[model samples]
Target: MTEYMPIMLDVRDMRVLVVGGGRIAGRKARQLAEAGADITLISPEAEPEIRELEAAGTLRWLRREASEEDVDGYRIVYAASGDETLNERIAEAARRQGALVNAASRAQAGNFIHPAVLRRGRLIVTASTSGAGPSAASALIRELDERFGDEYETYAEFLYFMRKKVRETVIEPETRHRLMRKLAETDILDQIRQDTFVPWSETEAAAWIEREREE
Candidate 1:
């Protein structure tokens, strides 16, 4: 068994082919569409959501069964036809053509597995069970969703601005490290949970750092 490695792909404007028209294919198509991929779904039948996207011209629809040729000129291919034999053929074709393939029916058949991911602005958290139990992975994602609320989102944004400001204002490397250490020790999330404003300004962050050092 191959060890599953986690990675994020930049799918913007990439050509993605989804071989299926059922619910599974529709779900995959929707996700790829949301990621700004040029999705082409090949299936004889489509779910209601797929039809809506097709009608709205958000995605291209081919009312025909998938073939090896469908993998051609595509950056990524997803085989979710629910047929083991068909999915295997798709995967083989994608491999021979040097295209990345994802077989939703069998994770072992594909090179990668899609993880349950939650995104908040620049913060992205993903969970996977190596394709053993997708349901369990989904459950874990839900649990994380409940435990880590919007505070994490705000914290990520705060860090982004802080890093940029540090580059612009703090010239000394030692000074920058000191400031970052102080920010890390201040427990900004705890303060946010306690209903305090997230201090993003240099002066506010410095004050919080001083208070933490005194404690």
Candidate 2:
């Protein structure tokens, strides 16, 4: 088994290929398109959303079966065709081109697996079961989505701003570490829950730190 190195790829302006027109393929293509990838979907038939994207010019839909040439010059390829033989062919072609290939049918055939992901502003959470059960992974992701709530968005945004401020204002490494620890300990989630938008100032954060130290 190859060790997976997790990475968040910026697919913006990259060419992506989807070799199926079914619901699963459409879902994958839609996500790639949303990430600003130049998606080309090759399918003899397409779902309504795929057709919609084609009409809207968000994605290019080829009304034909995927060919080896379709995998050429693509940064990433998704083989979601119902036909296992065609999917394998697509994967093989993509591998030959040194492009990243995702086999929706067989995980071992591809180099990477797409985890169920939830995005909240700059924060993204993903759930993966190493291809053991995609449905379980999706269910876990949904559970996390419900548990984390919208307050996490505000909390994460505040942390981003806090980190930037700390970098600019505090020069000492130890002091910065202490400050960051303090920020982590503070109940920012509680603040969000209470509808407090206090801007997460250094003074407030430092006071929280002092209070924690005393306790």
Candidate 3:
């Protein structure tokens, strides 16, 4: 069994091939499309949903059986044809041809595992169990979804905006560090969650730090 390492990939404008058109393949294809990959999906027959996306030109459709040649020239490939032997074969060929693969059945043939991901505006969370406990991972996501709501979206963005201002204004490393932590500790995020947050000026956020420095 391969111990998988988790990392995010920048697939924008990258070529990705999905070797199936069933429901499973359609789901993965939709996700890759959302991540901005230039997708080519190959299948002799496809679900109506996948065909609908193809009709819209969201991804190029190759209405044919996938071959080893189809596995080449792609940055990433999804082996999801539901045929165990062919899926494994495609995974092996994809790896040999220098492409990352996400296999629906076999884990060892691929380099990475996909975890259950939760994305809020700027807050993204991923839960996985090394592919052993997918149910547990999904249950954890439900718990997290309840605790972290839309409030986190605005709160996270606010913190980022203020961090940049602190970088430019706060010269002392120690003082800058303290202010960054303080910004989070203040009731600001709570305010954002409750829909009571008001935008603050640069001096408004940094004023207390200036006071401490002068003292």
Candidate 4:
């Protein structure tokens, strides 16, 4: 088995092709659509959710079997036709077209694999078992979801806002780096859990940075 490297891809508005009409294809299409990918789903028939998305203009659905030529001009291709042979064919076509392919039936046949992911605002946690155990990966993601609750969303957002403020305010590179680390190491998460977390405005953040400099 090939070792896969984890990466965060920015697929916003990227042309993507999904070859399948079953539930798996619908799921992959929905995830890609949510990430702002320009998706083209090729399937003779589709699940209700896929149809809804097509009707809502979220993606273009070609109601027919995918052809090898359909893989052209796509940045990413998902071969999820539920038939191993069809998926393999699509994967082969995608690879020839210099597109990254992910085969649903066989991860090894493709160049990439999807991990079980959990999102909390800007916080994203992903787990993969190297295609050996998807259920284990999902279970791990579920555990992480329970550990990092809704409060984490607000916490992460606050940190992101503060990070920008820190970069803009703190002039010294070392000081800025230290302050950035200090911000994450603070007891803010505890305060959030206790319902006492108050967001700092730009002025407050600057004041805090100045105080840290003094200390």
Candidate 5:
């Protein structure tokens, strides 16, 4: 078994092919499209939700069985026809075309694998068992979701804004890192989760920066 090297690819404007119309295929296609890929789904028939996306012009839908020709021009290919044999065959053709292929039934057959993910705006947490156990990864993700509430997304965005400002304000690189780390370790996340946080104000951040400079 090949060890998977984890990566978060930016699929924006990349040509992605999904060669199945089943629910799992549809879900994977939707995630690709949501990430700004130019998605083309080739399946004789697709799940209702995927068909709806086609209707909405979110993706190009080829209402036909996948052929070798369908693999051309795709940067990424997802083989998810639910037939393990067919998926592997599709994976073979896609790899020949120099496309990175992900087969639903067989992780080792593909160059890449997906981890269970939780997202809150710019914040994303991923759980993976290194292809050892997907169900365990999913369970771990669910547990993390319980621990990190939706408010964490807002917390992430807030930190993004502040961190950028800190970079601009704190001229010293080491000082900026210390200030950012200090802010992250504070009770802010807890306060947000408990709904006891004052409406976020840059005033507190400014004060903290000043105090850090003094110390």
Candidate 6:
């Protein structure tokens, strides 16, 4: 069994290739495009959703089967042509081109796997079963999705702003660490849950850090 190391990829504006035109391929293309990937999908014909995406300027759809050379220059490749043999061939080409690949038809043929992902503003959560099965991973993602709600998005953004403020204003390392920790330990989340969390302004953040520094 292959032990997969979990990672958060920054695929924004990265070149990606999706070789397929069916539901699975459209799904992959949609996800990649949503993540800000520059995608070029190769297939003789694509599903309506993919066509819409192309029309919207989200991704380019090439009307043809993918050749090995198509995998070149792409940072990531998704081989989801719905044909096991074709997927394997695409995966092999991706490997030779030094591009990461996700093969929908056969996971073992690819070097990487897609995990269930949930995003709440700055908060990103992912779950993977490492090839055991997707059902279990999806179940875990659902549970976590419910556990973390929209309020968390605001909470995360608030924390990020405060942390950056603290880093910029506080010169003392110890005080900075203490203030950062205090921000995390604060009851802001409770207020957020209660719909009472007031966003901190730059002046407010600075004043809070100053008061903490005095203590």
TM-scores for every candidate against the unseen true structure? 0.83, 0.84, 0.85, 0.95, 0.87, 0.92
Give the Cα error of residue 112 in candidate 1, in Å: 0.4
Q: For residues 1-215, write the lDDT of model 5, one tens digit per residue.
A: 57677888999999999989999998998898788989999888889989888887879989888877778888999998877888888898989888899999888767788999999889999998978999999999999999888889878987998897798788988898888888888888888888887755678778778887677
Q: Is candidate 3 or candidate 4 better by lDDT?
A: 4
Question: What shift in Å separates residue 155 of candidate 2 from its native position after superposition?
Answer: 0.8
Q: Candidate 5 — which residues are off by over 4 angstroms?
A: 170-172, 202-207
Q: Residue by residue across 1-215, what tens digits does model 2's lDDT show?
A: 55777889999999999999999898998898889999989999999989988998989888998887788899899999898888888898899899999998898787788988988887899988878888999999999998887888888998888777777766778877887887888777797889875775678755654564444
Which residue pairs collide in model 5, if any? none
lDDT of 4 by residue, 1-215 (tens): 67899999999999999999999999998899899999999999999989989999999999898888899999999999978999999899899988999999999889999999999999999999999999999999999988999999999999889888888887898988898888888999899999998888878988998888777
lDDT of 2: 0.85
lDDT (10s digit) by residue, model 6, range 1-215? 89888888999999999999999999988888888999999999899999999999999999988888889899899999967888899999999988999999888888999899899999988899997989999999999988999998999999899888888887889888898888788899999999987898888888898888888
Candidate with top TM-score is 4
Instruction: Pick the winner on lDDT between candidates 5 and 6.
Output: 6
TM-score comparison, 2 vs 5, better candidate:
5
How high a TM-score does candidate 6 get?
Answer: 0.92
lDDT of 2 at 66: 83
Q: Give per-model CA RMSD.
A: 3.7, 3.6, 2.8, 1.4, 2.2, 1.7
Model 3 scores worst on lDDT over the 10 consecutive residues at 206-215
Q: How many residue pairs clash in all the candidates, one count each?
A: 0, 0, 0, 0, 0, 0
lDDT of 4 at 75: 91
What TM-score would candidate 4 get against the native?
0.95
Ordering by lDDT: 4, 6, 5, 2, 3, 1
Model 1 lDDT tens row, 1-215: 57877888889999999998889988898888788999999988899989988987879999988887779998899999978899989998998888888998888877888899888778899999888889999999999889888888888888777767666666778777777776766577787777786566678655554554354
Candidate 2 Cα misplacement greater than 4 A, ranges: 167-179, 200-215
